[model samples]
Target: MSEAPSASPHTPLPAAVPPLTAPSVPPHASSALLASLAPLLHEWLPRQRWFAGKGRPVDRFTLVSATELMPLTGSPGLLHLLVRAHQPQTAPPSGSRGAPPPADCYQLLLGVRRSLPTSLASSLIGQVQDGPLSGHSVYEAMEDPRLATLLLERLRVPGPLGSLRFEKEPKADVQTGLAPRVLGLEQSNSSLVYGDTFILKIFRRLHPGANPDLELPLALAQEGCARVPEPVAWFEGANPDDPYEPYTLGLLQPFLREAQDGWQLALRHLADGRDFTDEAHALGRATAEVHTALAAALPTLSLGRPQTELLADQMTDRLDTAVQAVPALLPYAPGLRRAFDALRRLSSAGPAVSAQRVHGDLHLGQALRNGDGEWSVIDFEGEPAKSITERRRPQPVVRDVAGMLRSFDYAARTNQPWNPEWAQRCRAAYCEGYAAVSGTDPRTMPELLRAYETDKAVYEVLYEARHRPDWLAVPMAAVQRLATT
Candidate 1:
C-alpha cells in the first residue's frame, strides 16, 4: 500500500437542489389536457423508486416525443415520453458563466389513452379503478399495468425491439427460461426475474454505449473469474443514428437463486456466534484472485511512486468534504490528518504494485454465498449515478478491499440487535484470508486498512447524507472509530 496525500481545506455548501415541484409538459393537444396530465406524471414519478430526479425541482419540462404501444380498450396502449427537466446551474464565483443548467432527462414509459369528458377531469391521472375514466364512460386508462405488460412482451420477443435489433444466432432461440417477474427493489431501473433463471434489468434512464454490467463481467468471466453472474445476453439496438432514442434497454444474466446475500449471511454468522474468520479469509482470497485476474485481463495504468501517497491524497479529499458537511467531524480532524501522514510515510517503505482494473463498488451486497459454498458476485453496474468514464478508471485493488471491509461493518451495525461483535470477527477473518493469498505483510495491513476504511467511511457519510440520512450512524460511527484508533 502507498502513502496517502494531505488533507484539504473544508468548505460549507448549500443543499444540491431545492425541494421538488410538479413538472409542466405542455400538452400537444390542449392546455386543458396539459393541466390534467402534468400533475399526474409529477405524482407518479416521485412514487417510483426508478425515477432519478425524485425530490428534485423540475425547472422546466419538454416532451421530445411520444409513442403508443397498444390499443386503449381490450388491449392496453403503452405511452412512452421523451421528457427533460432543467435544474439550476451551479457556477463558480468567477466572471465566466458555468456549464449549462443540469438537465434531468429520461424516457417515461406509461399506459395512457383519451378519457371521456366528465363533470370534471379526475384529480388522479393514472389511478386504477374498477370501471372506465368515468362511471358512465366507456374509455379507461392507466400507466403501470399497461406499460409493464408491454415491456414484458417486448422482452419476450425473440430479438430486440424497434431499430434495436440483435444478430441472429443459432443459440438465440435456446431457452433461457426467462419468465419476467418484476422486482420491487429499484429507483431508476425496472428489474424483472425471467423464469427464476435470469434477471432483465431495464434501465429507465437512457445513455449511449454498452451497459457496464454486460461489458465488464463478460470480460472478467472470459478472464476465468467465476465470481460474477454469467452474462447470458444483452438487449440493445444495432442502429447508432438515433439520439433521444432508447437502446440497450436491458440485460439478461443467470440469477443466483440458492445463495444468501453476503450481507445477510455475515449478519447471521455474527448473530449465531459462528466464527467468520474462515469465511472472511475465503472472501479475502477470492478478492485477491479477482484483482489478479482483472489485472491480467485489463490494461495496466501507471501512477507515480509511493502508492501510499496517492491513498493519503484520496483520503484527505474525502475527509475534507465530510468535515464540512457534518461539523461533528471537526474534532477528529487532527487524527485523520495524522493517519494520512503515516500512510504517506509507509508508501515509500515498499515496492509499488502495478495498478489494475478493479471492481469500483465491492461490498457484501455485491456477493452471494451459494448453496455449494462458493461466493458469486453480481451487479457490475458500478454506481449507477456516476458517468461511464469515472466507472472505467483504473484504481488500486485495496480500494475494493476497503469497500468489503466497510460492508462488513455495515452488516454488523445493521444487525446489532442480533450481535454486536459481528463486524470485528468478520474483519479479522477477511484480512487474514486476504493476507494469506496476496502475501501482504501483517504489519503493513493496519495503515492500508485504516486508509481504505477511512476512505470508505467518508464516502458512506456523504452517501448516507444524500440518500438515507437515517442510516448515517453506520458511517459516522466508523469515522469516529477510525479517528480514535
Candidate 2:
C-alpha cells in the first residue's frame, strides 16, 4: 500500500471537479440493445440493495469500461461485460403541469451480460422495451456459472486495479478470495464484505471530488488516529478524460471482525440494566481525541453565519417536502416550525464557534465496538445524495457530536425489542462522555447540543419520510421531545 498523503494542515487542496469525456459512441445507443437490457438492470439493481437509487429509472447509460469473464459452456462467442454507466444530467420539461419535472440526472447502472440461458428465459424475457429503455437488466448464460464465479473471483483478487494503499500493513494475514457478502446497510452504494476480514465499497454515483471517506480516514489513520479503520488502498485511475474517470470508485479496508456496532453495544448495556456512564464517558473521551487529532492534522476553516443560514434554509425546505409527503406530519408542523426557528436563531447568533472540518456524517452506525471493547469509526462519506461540493465543505465539530447523540437515540428507540430503558440511559451516558472532553460549561453546551440536535432531527424527518416511513416516528418523536424540553 502507498503511504498516506501528508497531514500538514496547510497542504494545497485539490479541485472537486471530476474529469469528463465525450461519449465514444453516440450518446444514445440503439433502442434495441438498451431495451433488451433495461429490465435486467432495473430488477437486478434494486435486488442488489447496494444500488443507490432503488425503483428509479436509470436515465443515462455509458459503458465506461468492461472486463469479460470466462465463456459459457453451451454458448459460443458469448461474453459478460462488467459495465459501468455514467449518470446524465437533464432538466424537467418546462411548464409541465402538476407532474413534477423529470429527474434531472441519470442513475449509474452496472451491467452484467451473457448469452440468454434457456431455463431462465421466463425470468429474463419481456423486460426489454421498444423506444428508450424503461429499466436496467443483466443477461446471463445458462450453460455455465463460470461467468458469475469469475466475476466474484475478480472482486476478491487484490490486483493493482482493486488494491488500496494502507498507512500500516494489516496485522491480520491479508488473503484473497473470501466469499463476498453484500451488506444490506447502505442505500446509494454497494458494499461487499470479503471473508469477513475486509470490505470493498463500490460507489454507484460518479462524482469528481476525492471521496471524503476514502481521503479523510486515510489521513486520520496516517496521523495515528486509532478510532477509525486503518487506511487501505483505493481504486482510482490516472486518466481524467477516459470513460473511467479518475475518482475513488471503490475502497478496500480492514473489517472489524468481532466488534459490534456502537449503537448495538449501547443498547446491550441498556438491556442489561447497566449504567452507560462509563461507555458514554469513554465515547466522549474518544470523540475529543479524534477532534484534537483532526485539528492537529487539518487547518481550521472559517464558518460564517451564511453557512448556518444555508443549513437553516435546507432544514426549512426539507420540512416543507416532508409535510407534503406525509400529511400526517402536518399536525406537527407548529412544533417543527419551532424547531426550525430555534435553529435559525442559533445560526444568527453570529459565529459563536469557528467552523473546522468535521465528519460529514457521524452517527452510531458509522462506529464499531471492536473485540477489545474499543470504538472505531468508519464511513466518512457525507450524505450520499448530496453534491460533492456540499459534502466537502467545512462545518462545526458540534455537528458531528450532534450526529452521534442522535444515533444513540436511534439505537435506543430502534432496539426497544431488546431493551426498554435503552434510550434514556444511553443518552445520559453519551452526554456525560461529551461533556468531559468538550470542556465547555454545561450552560453553553446545552445551547450547542440543542441547536445541533434540532438540526439533525429536521434532517431525519425528511430522510425517514422518503426512505423509511416507518421510522419517521423516530425523528418526529425527537422533535416533540425537543420542543417540550
Q: Report lDDT per candidate.
A: 0.61, 0.57
User: In candidate 2, what are the lDDT values of residues 52-162, reduced to their tens digit?
Assistant: 555455655444432223321222212322234333334433554565422322223222223334433433433334333333223432212332223333333334331
lDDT tens per residue, model 1, 399-446: 788888888888878865735476777777777777787787333656
Give per-candidate clash totals: 19, 13
Off by over 4 Å in 1: 1-38, 63-74, 79-82, 89-102, 113-160, 163-179, 237-248, 305-314, 342-353, 417-421, 435-448, 465-470
For this target, which candidate reaches the highest TM-score against the unseen true structure?
Answer: 1
